[model samples]
Target: MDATVNACIGSDRLFDSPTTMNASVAIESEMKWISGMRPILSEEDFFTWMSLIIYVTLFVALIGIISNLLVIITCARIGFSETINISYLALGIADLMASATRFYGSIFLLFEITTTKVHFDPRTVSSVVAFLPSQGFEKTAAFITAFIALERCLCVQFPLHVKTIVTKRKTIFSNVIIYIFAFGPSNLIHMVYRFKWVYNATQNRTVLAIDQSETRLRYILARALYAYYGTILNFTALIVVWICTVYLVLGLKRKAVARKENFKTSFIKDNKQKDLQVIKTVFLLAVTYLVCSIPTAITLLVPQFVPEFGSTRALARISRVSYMISGLMMQVNSCTNFFIFLYMGSRFRKALITLFKRH
Candidate 1:
């Protein structure tokens, strides 16, 4: 589940970067490990497959950029209100950033692979690769989803105090905090450790290599941090989202039933129905996030629990394929949220149309 696209990381020929003997040995060991694990494929065949994967991933990244940009624009046009539009706007902005970075990496990789004579700045490439995914926008998006769902739950349970408890000011402040926590620490360590200008013997030039240090403790701690923040925290947030969504839905249904029993056509009943629709729309978004995230989470977590799984070449290949599928699912989820809004949010759809007309 290595989503970052640095060439020097986990790559063979790119390791010509000068490093400590320990780092060099580690690089050699990785090369040997990859050689043993690589599935039997012709050079031409492997590149062809890689090309296809790169192209598809790039295409999805592009689509996500456009779609999320539209979502952000629409959110801005509609203005924030009580319907978790602020959360959607935050999510859209985060996804837009992630998609744009992914697009750059994919396009750069494609160009690098297709060209025989390499002419690129490794420092720039390594910096981008190390910094882009490290920004933790994905985790921010996940957190925002959970917050949105939890807010809905609170609204359903305490509609009378919803305004007091969940003010726009509070929401904005919380979002700022999320951005600070999500985007800062995860990337700071990566930015510090990943960039180094080293001589590549094969390329016969100085190239910047994004390589980890020989400090096993540092590597282990980084992985631990990643597991804690990227996987465990996200999983926790998702569980909260699921719980809140279920409670909110059941509460809404019960209220709707009570309203129906009291009167055939009451204002409260109409409002309840509309609220239910909005909740259901958000529930769809939560479900997509949950479903799409499972594969990536499993792929990331499985090896920790099942140490022998990666020992087998066949299992490793299966894991790689699973990761690719999960990555694609994530990309699709990011790209299609605007479409979901279009389908489920009447107000959002009208706002989108108005935005287009204004342009």
Candidate 2:
């Protein structure tokens, strides 16, 4: 959802001196930034829509928090001796993190919206504190989803050897590395930009402003990293998921054809059915990830091609709507996985039932 905001914050023109900004006369508004400026909609209309969206996001985040917690608990109880369990467990954790952060950010925005007058800009504060971590969790989830897809593809491609090649220990190590890669850049950004109390002219009060405490070289590096995370990192993960998903689909189709052409014994038939069921679960997951990601990807990619299409540029207003759409989809994606697991993952379902019975 915030691939653009989270990834492009470092390179934003608004990163001038981190001095306190006048809420009304800030030199630059951030991408997907919350403001009273009218986009295609009039100011009142825009804010109404934004308010509705913020409320919806808050609802989704709450549901997601509960759902993902269940997924985590179920996965833990199910155990992770199997490599697939390890991936599922990691994915649950990542989605849980994403949902929690989204909830945190959404609550702040809701407060800002409802209050008649506010001293601090809750949306502005959330942009950094909640969005950055949310982005990291989203990115981490993307990588783990892609990893799940790729792992399944390998298993299908090399049935006998895959178990040995993709062991549980190896899966654990891979998830750890994915977490590091996804979160490292965002955390680095936290270090470079420190928040401080500064007088905001628009609010007529002191508020925490993001203060920069880095050298010129570090600033440039941060920009490059942000650009990479926003564009290249997401692009790579999306492409990988796409390719793996296609490969798995084709393999399944070919197997279907083979099954129709040849007769198998009951034992063989049962085993093949089990394999197909597993593939179906992964296929559903990959497709869900792919469909949900396209909107966010467009927001991230469009600015790269159209230099004028920035958070502070000519197309800023239109892009806010796009951001709203994309943000909602990503949140849906984060929360939606638990249901997927519940319906498709037999082991997970059993574990969840057992968990509920225990409680």
Candidate 3:
């Protein structure tokens, strides 16, 4: 979520800052400019709040990730024959990695704010450090959700085919694809631009800069490419998962009706239970994704209409709040999937309880 919001804001912010600075001289020459300009918020106040909130959220997420990992490891160590359990294990591992990455990234960002008193340079190493893993994990989490959707779809649509297709080998392969899809573009960008640190005498601080062409076209094209690539792919994956989820639900409903009408009482009871479980799991995940993602998407999409809303200070403030809320929500999404499973899935809850009892 932070990744999406940052990508949306960082690109445009970097693009516009130079122009705005250049325009400041013209405004200063004309006293009339002062009449329309709104007062800017103090940097200290902004940084203080941002640093506190990010660090606190990071700490909470760290604790949740650790607990989830313990449960996952315990479940894996104990004998487990069920295939879905293995998928949950994989999901837990992905969630843990995402949470750890977010925690460290947040800490680094908070430190950067306090120690350097410098703005994050989006074209440099600082930007990569701040944005890369967040984007990577954002994509990875989407892939994992899609994988889970695919698994559920298979169970409902092709029960016999699922046994052969949804194996440990396939799960590993899917994870590899997720990593490649998520990190490949950002890594490539990092390789192209070597980031260097420099001391800014005027600001009395260290700043990171990238060795790239100074042409406006180059920066515009680069950002456009990244925005196009990242948003399209991630959003597409999200849509795919939604479609798969809908199909799964419809299939389950059809099966339930068929079972009821066939006078197969035992089959109805068993199938109904499985159907309900799938519905619960899918619905929970879908709702979480919506709650976590929609605000970020709105923030991203809002800036694209800059000509329409950019001049409004209220809109700008709203965008900032939306970006922050989206970041918090995405972190929540990354850290809470395990708890969702624990709440909704009987097998996961039982396994967790048993593990805790043994400890």
Candidate 4:
């Protein structure tokens, strides 16, 4: 998920760096522990790599948008007869939106780099178009992936009963709930923070600033939601997905060894192959999601147990870089699923092929 955004305790927004804001505002808004905190990387060194990171992010966003779009279209074409289909569709939408927002940020940064008329901080561009939306979508994807893993786990354990339990109507409702609970809260960003133009006298340029003029209650609510995305939502998803993935992996090994006997009980040979393929596809997705999620997960989770690892504590510097790395990995997560399905999902591949032939 979102670990940090140059500020945001990996995504919590508590540490958001609004450099152009008044010093009094900064003091009032920020945690006292980070009053003079510094990054591990020297300013010179970090700036040197910033452009390359932006370019890489741009590339990731492009690939993610196109790939997730392919998945979205394919799932729609294939129909949502299975909970897996609807789950994939929801995830693709989330990933696509995240990538799209990040792509806009990439372009915003590229413009900043090229234009001489104004000097814009990366954090400013990120706040305007990237971090909040990305955090929301990432949260959405995290829960969706967990749901898929759990759904698959049940299918593996109770093959005949899963469809009955996770019915189409129920799945549709669950997805609606996921969207509301996971993605809807992000709307608070708009209510809580407004953007304004500020001229930077030192740099001799105008810059974008995040103006905190909202009600205290609104700000507190958004802050809590942001914390939820960075911590509770991700933490729960990671644990659930990890447990389910482990169970599914072990089940796959056992099922592989007894494929003939297990499927023969009721499922046809073709259905057996399809079911196995779906499992493998979901396994790859869950594994990639977990891998990408770890940096943020560890960064966010550690502060809860050991206060020193917090955004304002000893690990703050490393936490910042860790969050940045996790951000890159998150983009990678958004884009890589297309390849996973292309290689492992026969039904997905067939649907894609059929779609192209129709075109």
CA lDDT, every model vs. true structure: 0.63, 0.70, 0.57, 0.69
Question: Ten consecutive residues with minimal summed lDDT in candidate 4?
Answer: 17-26
Give per-model TM-scores. Answer: 0.80, 0.84, 0.74, 0.81
What C-alpha lDDT, on a 0 to 100 scale, does residue 19 get in candidate 3?
8
For 165-263, candidate 3 gives per-residue lDDT tens digits of 788777767767776776555455554456667664434677675654555754665565456434675577668777886887688777777656655
How should the candidates be ordered by lDDT, best one leading?
2, 4, 1, 3
The TM-score obtained by model 4 is: 0.81
Per-residue C-alpha lDDT of model 1 across residues 1-359, encoded as one tens digit per residue: 12122223222222211110001222233334544455444334434655676688779878999999999988888887664888889989988876776566556555545543355543245333522352366667777888888888887788678889998898988888888876655554443455567666545787665554556655565555555555676678668877876787788877776656755667867776777777888788888888877776676577689864434433433443444455556666678788889999888899988888887
Give the alpha carbon lDDT tens digit for every residue of 1-359 in model 2.
22222222122332211111112111144434455544454445545666787788889989989998998888788887678888888998998888898787777656555542445556456656776677788889989999999998997788779989999888999999999998666666665666777775545688766664558865786566556566777788889999999999888877677765544588777766767777888888888988988887887767679754534523454455566667778888888888998888777888888888888
RMSD of each: 5.7, 5.9, 6.6, 5.6
Provide the lDDT at 69 for model 1: 92
- The whole-model C-alpha lDDT of candidate 1 against the native structure comes to 0.63
Give the 10-residue window scoring lowest on summed lDDT in candidate 1.
14-23
Poorest lDDT segment (10 consecutive residues) of candidate 2 = 17-26
Q: Per-residue lDDT of 111-136 in model 4, one digit per residue for the tens? A: 54444344454445455457666777
Best by lDDT: 2
lDDT pick, better of 3 and 4: 4
* Model 2 stretches with alpha carbons more than 4 Å out: 1-39, 115-124, 212-218, 257-268, 304-306, 310-314
